[model samples]
Target: MPGGIEGFDRNVFINCPFDKGYEPILQAILFCLIYLGFSPRIATEANDSSTVRIDKIRTLIESSLYSIHDLSRCQAGKKGEHYRLNMPFELGFDYGCKQFFTDQRCDKKFLILEEKAYRYQAALSDIAGCDIKQHAADYQKAVRAVRNWLVSEADIVADGAAKILGAYADFQEWYYERQLAAGFSEDDIKDYPTSELLAAMKAWVALGKPI
Candidate 1:
């Protein structure tokens, strides 16, 4: 579970549901992390068809010094549908790594997010003592939660959440226009891979995040 020190400090493992319902929050988290100068890592980033998902997740957790686990969607949305355990399970794994691992791994930091502020304690009481932030499905709140967390935990100076949100809007508008100019339809832009979008984010950040 040991990762190279080079990326260990900057990499952040993001644990959240990948359903379409959560896309905006996911993108917000990514944008916030990148905007604050962290490398966001998630299981889906592993594109090797043969790679086991859990294995990839473990590698990401072990390699990352920081992690964000959103347990907002852990409950079943409807009757007869099973609740999702993967989010909490991964959170547990990451927590165990921090508590049991040695040296720099002990310095690992975590940010737990839930859709509603107090809902997680009702179902996941074991982690009741942990400070969990609430977003209530608001992408702006998600951005603020992540921005504040990064500034506090990473000990890095950053513009406020409003600045990041404003830049996110700028990035989206620029990306949208650029994709349209590239001959992609509105629908096609939504279908673009996250890797491409993230690369563009990096490029945009490098270019000073022009409006």
Candidate 2:
């Protein structure tokens, strides 16, 4: 089935137990439950608050990544069933997020970047009636808070953290492009810190810059 909510309906038809005669009734109930279980809320409380929206989006992206990592571990297990479930679960998460935005691509090496871009776009759209400069400043401040935490406790950040850090740098670059496209002047976004920038970007995307 395709990853979007609509595709889920078609998928159930394909999994139909109706042809089996007696089991169709039971299967129908089961499918209904399954559908409800997997569906994400169409509108969240954060939708009204840009900051909350940005936080939720970043949480989704990180959750997706963590899910992927867990699936990888499952695939590496000696048990065959564990490995079998890994592929389907991983693919489902990938498709769900990919289908969330029309402009974002969802392949490896690009999923994180795509998520960031969609988030930024979402943030800007939500806060359009508000003060954009103040929003941007609040966003930057939140980012610096996260950066300060990471920098002060660098040793515990773990290995290969560079790769994660590099992804943020890429996100910043994409954010710059997005802001430019939105007609935000050069002076607006120039002073934001890059290293601790992911939190800021996430704030912008999820929470919609502070009040």
Candidate 3:
């Protein structure tokens, strides 16, 4: 069968910070999801300028059976800088869709993440009762939390988080060397598109995932 909302069983919408600083955690989440046989969908995958961004995000949420929202970057980093509301905004949208939509939509599952436990309560106090996971800005912890959540929600049985982390480390080394050998500049490799990165990850995992 074709994919998308009709195949929501494996589609996982990822709502998280897209800044350069959050790239490592983002990669870890994607790797964990792909490794466990889940399809990761993000707003960035769509590049049509004609459609409004909120509409696109809503479409993704409605089509996904599961979602992961990272609110770790909600706070501003420097003085006078405004805190980011996009992550929380998109999260609320997803929640609202699940709450007010049809039965399938209502069945949607969520995993909300923060940098530190209880820190989200300060800005988004309404989510106080939800089970919020803290990654503490550590990729290993993020991978563990993601893998555990998927195991609980998706009923997936996969390698332990520690093993996945080791695999990720090995992949990084292999990917870097391969890119350099292919004559890709450091900047080119670093700025590679998300779609290409994901394809490379899928290919790597399919090729026996050399360590």
Most lDDT-accurate candidate: 1
Relative to the true structure, candidate 1 reaches a TM of 0.95
Stretches of candidate 2 exceeding 4 Å from the true structure = 1-159, 191-200, 203-211
Q: Sort the predicted structures by lDDT, highest score first.
A: 1, 3, 2
Point to the candidate with the largest TM-score.
1
- In model 2, state the lDDT of residue 136: 20
lDDT of 1 by residue, 133-204 (tens): 999999999999888888899899999989889999999999999999999999999977778778888999
Error of 3 at 127 (Å): 0.7
- Model 1 has an lDDT value of 0.89
Q: By summed lDDT, which 10 consecutive residues of candidate 3 come out lowest?
A: 1-10
| Cα TM-score per model | 0.95, 0.21, 0.93
**Candidate 3 lDDT score at position 198:** 87
Model with the higher TM-score, candidate 1 or 2: 1
| lDDT by residue (tens digit), candidate 3, 157-200 | 88999889888888888888889999999999999888878888
lDDT of 2 by residue, 63-156 (tens): 3211111111222225444333422343344456555644322321111111121322342343234211111222232233223322332222
